[model samples]
Target: MVCAAMLILDVLSPLLLLSILLPSYGCRAADIPEDATSEFSVRLYHQLQAAGEQDNIIFSPLSVAMALGMVELGARGASLEEIRQVVGFSHLLPGVEFSLLQNLTAALSDDDSHYVIRFANSLFLQEGVTFNPEFLHLVRKYFQADVETVDFSESAAVAEQINNWVENHTESKIRELLSAEDFTSATRLTLVNAVYFRGSWKNQFRPENTRTFSFSRDDGSEVQTLMMYQQGDFYYGEFSDGSQEAGGVYQVLEMPYEGEDMSMMIVLPRQEVPLASLEPIIKAPLLEEWANNVKRQKVEVYLPRFKVEQKIDLKSILQDLGIKHVFTSNADLSAMTDGKDLYIEKAVQKSYLEVTEEGAEGAVGSGMIALTRTLVLYPQVMADHPFFFVIRNRRTGSILFMGRVMTPEVIEPNDHDFDSM
Candidate 1:
């Protein structure tokens, strides 16, 4: 599978811009399971909602973009059922497909949710075969899957070219989301790509003007981390329930991308506590509470500027993480095809992120200006251990993709998704 494309974790509104942009394009839902449609929509909505609640130093408008790409990938005649299955688990991984699917599904009536996704495949070209009228009709309704065939002298060359295109597409958010091993490791034809993005807070930070701050870990050891400080109109709010004897406010940091309508929103607990410890306190309701409650204040904010990178083979972890049924052979995805024997060969997820304040330069005088951009050399939440990741859409309810990385080593050797132990 290709790495995620740029994803934007936008926290605008249910009537977010994307939602308003694409309204209902009716695609009939085939009769089958009860509540499949509703379940899909709820899952998609909650997934993106969850992404908006996470603490992010890495911003990828990948969820929707990647989903769009994959919706396009479906034109290659990748399994229709498998596409649906991949989209379903995408929320767990929060990959780009998950984000785009969220947008595609929003148009379906609550009862016809499954029907909307049924036509999502129409957006791309299937190598040589044209979809039958039933499936083609749905595709014609929601998405126009038009793809052109590219001819290369060698398959390896073609693959590498595709990889290069991906690297460039992501603004190098991924230089080598895939590598040479990616070419050699797959039993089936493999596809690898990435979505890279770097955007500074419209208001930047000065690195030489950095201050050493204490950052606590889950184990209670307070390590000194540079706190990048800036003051702006934040989604500020506070909460009172936690095991730590300290009550903290949720200080939100919004960093937008240079050329996209996407931004990364990080939620820092206003406490000298480890970010890991406050997991239970981080949830959708909490964000809703914070966004709705925090009184705007010109408060002094201290945050550690650190970078983290992680790689993982998410296939196994996903099944273990509450997404077992879809990957199995029995997965029912007739909604994509009128019940084809298509099966998911593999569902793998890999991700990398970095956060830092190195070489950061900007201003913070409690004011607003446009050209305040700081390029931090070292960046993102370090992925040494385990952390949650997702590809989300700015709008809609469809998890196009999802996965988790418990270990980076799995991807380090550049093993493809099918090579997992």
Candidate 2:
């Protein structure tokens, strides 16, 4: 339901992976509110941005929302209220969000002919624990989650099985997401959610146009990376936050995938300005503004072929976001089972994204002067430096992935390139 957020063409790669695990909690139903989801996505990005500092960040806001939704199904008292408040779902009628979530995900998974977007949700419970049938039914009704019984005492085997399920759903792009150390005898239930997406660019870059180029990092370090160049018509705009917090000017470029249903929006700061200066101004309204304002025009684009992956500890992040009660001993998750002792032990999410040419021939742009001079006929988006990006559904306005590229793909130094010494 959340529409847009900050930066890169992450899902443009061959694969984009996200796997979520919550030990001892589960979710329930939903029709997701778009604006609410967008706000939540922006908030999540801000947290990840602050925590990551100058590092590259990539994660699926929708995946996390769904994971929490699963937990909410079994949550009661403060646990349910906290999730509702943090996610901005309090305004909606109770149980309506389940239908919303189901409809939104169903819409996304509808057209797989052009791109591949898959969602796999499952609940793994300890062999002896008896879960409430009605709660399980609601989870399946809204999230379509598969329910399985496993021996959590065999931590290693359980970890491998869960990781294998994640890998299988994500095209093996993300493997070994959970290790033996992630599970223990106290783990009675684990809710898993995996999202995998692969989409090709509408205007595919020619492989020949991709050449080694210098990528400047935020810390003034530079790395060699394969930069894909193209001169095509894309949604473009220049925006200013109207304050000193962010540099006066920034560029927003929206590149659609094979189907117009989805797009990748890249937000690039001025070459001299650090991306950190611009990130603070990124909010839900700003994202909507970017979505509405960009005009379709020819632009020169130079984006590096890169991959960004990260594993986030959701427990700490959620606690920071004022959702701590669910993970504590005093939590109320009786909706799932009769045992009042059930409390979430750990919540983790690992995401991976890669950007590539999608095996299409690229068109060389006209103009050596454009590359040489400071001024060019069309607006140019040269991502030779760090930038923020988001991959979203153009039609539904759901952000599939949001992240920033601080360092592009790096190639190590080779002896042959240096003087024969």
Candidate 3:
């Protein structure tokens, strides 16, 4: 069965706000190397691709990494090794990895009044379970995770409490994250992470300019959908593993958000090449090459206004990625508690993203001045087919969200009828 990507942490601040644009004091920008975050992003994206296949995928790699990192803190021996390998934490020093995560989380959550981006982490323990004081302190200090005692016996109430927390953090875009069926009497610990982001395009698409355009699916079939169009100077580049005519060629375009510090990079495979063909070659080095070589050019661009809401169960995916000891009888969470076997019963993540013409309030401070003259026909980069995208922090090179749009459809606002974890 195919599954949607689920991303997950945080304390219960009445308003758990962190800055994304401007760096918080003492949060050094160089702590987390750009290559490290990029490598993690690409690795997670490829894993999601293998699992989700031709389905639409949307999840925050950063959210998943932070959530798993919380679990990593308490892991020992084989559990620790597997977790590190799967989550890309093996390369950095243990202390440095935790510090980098703490710093990166603070930096990404810090945002101005223009964009709304927030990340939250929380831990729910079965009532009467005694957790290790050191584990609690570490999670609280690094991830700002709020710990709550919930009675697993009262499954309904526990589900409601957890769902309420998720709804509040995601602006209600994700509700009912946990249901009664997901909990059991043996469930001793539950860790959750939710992120909500709403940003307007730096170059807003005219509402009137949005027209029905054909989008090709993976099966070579086509469907008509609303496509937003605009012409402007954007960062663009082409990728070809060999000769362009030999078929491994694609286009990459960077569209910045209102703040200019965050942007989405769209990868459009050439018409003759299937998107699947390019998936295997997606890595940090390729992304770095694109970033270093892309040039500013005037072009006609078309992108679909899309929204993807996905709830995913991460157990299988984690196991497939070599994190096996954490789920089975060999689990070692002694750091968290000496309570009964505390293997993760359920690991779920719910994420929501909406792209529209309006960015932040003061998005357009200066009006555009166009001079009338003989216009030169600009190259067109139309994304009317299957493509992959990565929304990232320009300053940190941390991938906030990544996904593939296979079949673009006009999903009505507030439609929560998609698949559930």
Candidate 4:
């Protein structure tokens, strides 16, 4: 989120590749606000600055390389709002490269569902997908599945290859998350990937003295998440209030990666909280609070090393999320397509995260094939039942696809992509 914001803001949409870092980065005088602006963009810019404000140095060319790629990937037919979401969400990554990788699907094709496979595959072959990646063409051909239940046995081979390549490219930081068996007979796969958070605390936590922590659920059921605790100088704070006036409680902890103090591990909730709702609480002021308020203490921190994998059925979810006008075949996409027939066919997201004392190691990958989500948007409380979630980038206010999980344990990874943004 640091100076990397500069590259995503200007370079991505322009399809520019950044190979070097600028001496100074981030928004200049022209980016700030004087009054009420777009809520999404306002919050976004604020958060971006909040993150970067702590470190006012130069940035490396590599920091923006991935963002530039994602910009190239998503620019066509992607609305201003969508582009904003991409940039805003990309800021969530701690590593420059991981943030860039999160937007891979930004390169997806804008054609109808029929073309997502070829379109996505072609992106892999693009100039900078990776110095070393899996056989891109083969994998795309394999997953361009159909709605009548695809025989993925052949595609499974491609999945294996892609997964292997991803694992290797990520230095084994990501694993077994994507599979050939996950492919559905459904049309093409649309997803987003967020990976690799290797950050230590601003102050190191002694591993030898780590202790087990009691984690209580809303229902009072409990499990133990190992907590990494250290008493000394560190960045810390509290949210003081739940998001959306929901009466929630949270603690913000910032841990730095040993080698890179400039890079850090940002833990949003001191306790387990529903991510869907927590999305609203992540604000620039809250982050500012953490940076300013943390005090040294003899604390007992307990956090679990856990993975959250979600696959969402985006077609219906988008319709329900309040953008119902465009999904219709007769809908007007002139804003995106240049006088051609086009409509969202399906949008799916896949996000994998691993949290531990060592920092967060995860990936959020998403893809789309002429599809979108449909939601009812009733005034019902989101807590009682499972619901879709998205971190619409503030700059663009794009919903960043949509997610739904009636049951996490029973969710089908191939059939859906609850993949959070």
Model 1, 159-199: lDDT tens digits are: 46555655554444444433333222112122222322232
lDDT of 3 by residue, 54-131 (tens): 777776677667777787888777887887766667787766778887877666556533456555777787677677
Best by TM-score: 2
Return the TM-score for candidate 2, rounded to 2 decimals: 0.87
Highest lDDT: give the candidate number.
2
Estimate, for each residue in 107-177, the C-alpha lDDT of model 4 and write its tens digit: 22222211111111112221221211222222233323111112233557545654554454344544564
- What are the root-mean-square deviations of the candidates from the true structure over C-alphas? 13.8, 7.5, 7.6, 17.0
In model 4, which range of ten residues has the least summed lDDT? Answer: 3-12
Q: What are the models' TM-scores?
A: 0.51, 0.87, 0.83, 0.43
Against the reference, the lDDT scores of all candidates come to 0.33, 0.71, 0.64, 0.30
lDDT of 2 by residue, 49-115 (tens): 9897789987778877887788789889988999998987898988777887888777666653466
Clashes of each: 45, 28, 17, 57
